[model samples]
Target: MSSVSVNIASKVQLVLRVALILVIFGWILDIPGYFGKYYYTEQLLALVAGLAATITLTDPRWGRTPARATISLVLGLTVFIAFGYVSVRYPSLQLELASAPPGAVALGLLMVLGILEAARRQTGIFLPLLLLALVLFSMFIGPKLPDGFQTRELSFSRLSVYLALDTNALFSKILDIAAITVAPFIVFGFLLNAFGGSAVFSDLAAKLVGKYTGGPAKVSVVGSAAFGMVSGSAVANVVAVGSVSIPMMARAGYARHVAAAIEAVASTGGQLVPPIMGASAFLMAELLEMPYRDVALAAILPSLLFYAALMLAVDFEARRLKIGGTSDRLELPAQNSDAPDKHRWRYLIPVGILIYLLFFANRTAGSAGLWSAISIIAVHLIGPPAQIWHRLQDVWKGLLQSAAAISDIIILASAAGLIIGVLNLTGIAFQITLQMLAISGGDVGIMLLLTAGLSILLGLGMPTVGVYVLLATLAAPALIELGIQPIAAHMYVLYFGMVSMITPPIAIASFAAATVAAVSPWRTSFASLKVGAGVYLVPVAFVTQPELLLDGTLLETATALTRTLMGIGLLTLAAIGHMSRPIPLPVRIIAGLLAVANVLPVSALPQLGMAAVAACSLAILAWAAVPARTTPSLKHENT
Candidate 1:
């Protein structure tokens, strides 16, 4: 609280911020061949800077007092020195380090503890605990297990070398992908919003869908989808778009919980869409060893189906509530379509460049992202001369913000790298696969359900990135072993992981949106589950048909896609129980059964037969209900 202490804290904060910027910039440019010589240096530098910032950011009650600042500096310096020594000394002394020199082992232990503390700081107890448990299991329990389950016993020196000195543990593939590919995209996403990209896209989305029945909700769906492409985090999506849409929906006469749920589900769906997909799409591509474009292409239809189902549910909700676009009932946000034409068109340039580079130029994802980030800066600088200086300031600030955002992910990915390292070292993934097979009796359906349940559970408390990583390594291999398409299996886990953002008990997205809408988090989360019912079904659909992932013939894909859409339509209606009037319970039940049959991975008997049954059941309900309900004219006059 003293002046000298305050100034010291301020200086430390500034230093950490600068370090963060340099770390991100270094990775993006791989400055002066550092990555080529010592890849771990670049990765470790980012990790260290992220941990430093997190310490400062989460400082004590005094808020970065001298004591806290001193602690942070010491911890950060120690990590930097440890990682620096390991990276610089290891290549030349590979054999010596492998022999368990006191210096190397001690440094490795420090790095491990630092990583564990960083994970605890960023994501809470679940992941760090899981990581520690894995490490303990690998070190102590593995050798005692039955012959089929036991891994080769590792000495302390050997485990330390693998975890800290080699590429197999802490510096594994997932971390490599995260640093080389995902971090750059995270920077690009932050850069887009720092420029005029967000406003431009919001205006464009409003213009495109702001006049529909549930105009504001639909706008949230559209805007969040686009924003999610860049942000790739459901929490970020909710904060960015829901800040505008949640209030707008409430003002348009939606219940507060309904408004919050709508925004929550829509933002969560952003991770399902491509080009950004909250970073999962890129990770999936890397894991599958496929081109990024192929991953995006396969994701296109399922993402569409996700939003299509959302749009319909929103529209039906609007009709059920009789919400409309009258001034008092609902109106477009004022910012939409109000920007000058010249400024608005600039938004498309970066997105167009990104698409061209990703699909046509066939650039590495990191390169594509770096170029896009540069293009965004370029467009901002080239804006109207009067705004250039101000825009330049915004870009500078954006660079710092992007660095801060990238740092957290670097920390997470590195910590997760530890879990992956242990899993590989102890052969735990194989053991898990075998256990899954045993529990499911080799039934693919049972395995899928169990995976879905496990994904949802992990997702409730973990970051989507971590959840996906765990599932991909442990659970997804089981699906692949059962003859599922590789992409289908991966996408299956990815979708369920994202759905956790809107699920009950701990729906992070719903909690965020509910705060914006002033609704109960519990109520909003349950409502999100209801509104996002299709999130649960779509993954199963793709897994069953594979055609939804474009893995089948054109005719077959089209036919399957059509039936699925019809099924989703009826499902939405049944879930909402509104079509002119609320549907009776009996009709709702029939509609539910019909929806399942239509989307079920079965032959013509259930698919066509259920479609016919649902149609008849709906007709009878409509005929009986319509006469008793108020006519449109009467309802309008009454309003």
Candidate 2:
């Protein structure tokens, strides 16, 4: 494409992005509260937003395919609208297969297909494929099937009726969470990123962590964690933070792949972290009818522990190679480097208000987000606040940042909708759960491995949130039935869902990081698995001691927290392959064994063993610290 055409295409894409962001969030938020008490508008809006997302994400290098795009978009909008509108508008008839028209039946299939395509474009094909498998089962399953696998019958009209009327299965609790909390938080993230809230955090992290060892990578982790708290999406975290941190890490002497992978993996961790975990936790609460805090509580330790592992791994690699910090000669820039210091405070105005809302005020997440945005922009634009026009421009830019992630969100909703609808029709969700349970032979460890594999499979072509939400719906029941606490059951699925992101063949985060790092994506992904191995152990940790999830008395929680911290420190050292200077491979392996024992559970022999290994590693490192006569304090390690 010529530069002019490319420029035009870019402009068009940006405009479409902004428009879809507004439509989706507006619909997702259901801002038309009074205007549309009717169900049709809501479903129709969802369809439009989903299609817009697919269109927006298409590689513009192919040029516009207006006819094809519009057809796909409209076909999708029609199906969902008909199902939602008709089912609500004619509920009695929708439930009666004999009374429904052929057009209505066609509409149902369209709704399923349209949603599948939207998901296919925005996420990957896994969800759509899964949804299709179940839908086809509903189409063909006859008598002689297992009890749970058998549905009412296989006629198109009958199947469509089941999908449309079964509100419990299709539109379920996820939509409720989406409307009440998740969507607003998504918008909150977008607005925060667009204006300058994230920029503020970046500037803050650079100042604080950038002066330390492994400064760039550490800064990425710290800044990404802070930013991830509100951003909601992992990939979005990369786009927002990686744009700045990746280049800086490379310039600071880290390999480009390592730099990018650090950002990607760190950003991915955001979905697991609180106060704003990947929109899934909120959905989990809604699904289980549990308190939101319950979800956050369960997630806390595991998130801290994962990042702890990451920090140690990165620090070790940096030290082993003696990668020095950025030349202090190049003085770091100020937070508001391009502007006056006065604007620095303006950025905090919003964040301060958000913190108060999230922590002390104890407001609903949606209300907190809305008010936070209002306060920042409103306070900044008052007569004494600042120039009204200038602040508006800044806020607008900030809002656009939020807009950019819309395509992915819409795709997620439609994809989730498809799975819910299809499985509801075939009763396949229950069957899948039952079969997996039977296969696992009632062992919790075996059940977890099965579900973990399932979660990863689901995650392969979908958003992490979409993946877990579906798995939690289908597979979590088996665990919950086996006496796993509702919270632990959901969290077990969530942990593996996150683990899937780091694992190939999907490895979305690793792939994103690889682009900036200049490392092969596969190699970086393998590195991710080794670094993120701690995550695999954490789900079991929480299950074994819910205290780690803050379920017990404060004292119990404290013990778990302390042990968790110790485990993290030990594991970090083990992962870095050093206690002091580089350890021999055998010693490193020995240290790894001791660290595992230390992290696993407290015991006299294992504790002594841990102490012995750590002490030995520390001693060796201490001796290395005493450099020979004129040798530099640092020495590089060979790869």
User: For each predicted model, how many residue pairs clash, with residues at least 3 apart or on different chains?
Assistant: 1, 7
Worst 10 residues of 2 by lDDT: 327-336
Candidate 2 on 152-239: residue-level lDDT in tens?
Answer: 4566676664453344533445544554466557666655554445656666766776776787777778788878877876776776
- Each model's TM-score? 0.90, 0.82
Mark the 10 consecutive residues where model 1 has the least summed lDDT: 327-336
Candidate 2 is scored at a TM of: 0.82
Clashes of 2: 7
State the lDDT of candidate 1 residue by residue for 1-639, as single tens digits: 446655655565556666655665576686847645445453454354344435334333234456665665567557766766655565464677658777778777788777777667777788878977877887789889988888667777777766775666676676667766777777778877666466666766777878867787887788888888778888877877776777788888789899889888888888777776777787789999999999999999999999988888887788888876522222222222333556756867988898999999999988898888888778767745787667777777777666666667766777777788878777888898889988999888899899988988988768888889889999999999999989999999988988887887888889998888777999999898778775577888898889989888999899778767766767777788775577788877777776666666756466567567557645643553463545579768899
- Cα lDDT of candidate 2 equals 0.64
Error of 2 at 259 (Å): 2.1
State how far residue 5 of model 1 sits from its true place (Å): 4.9
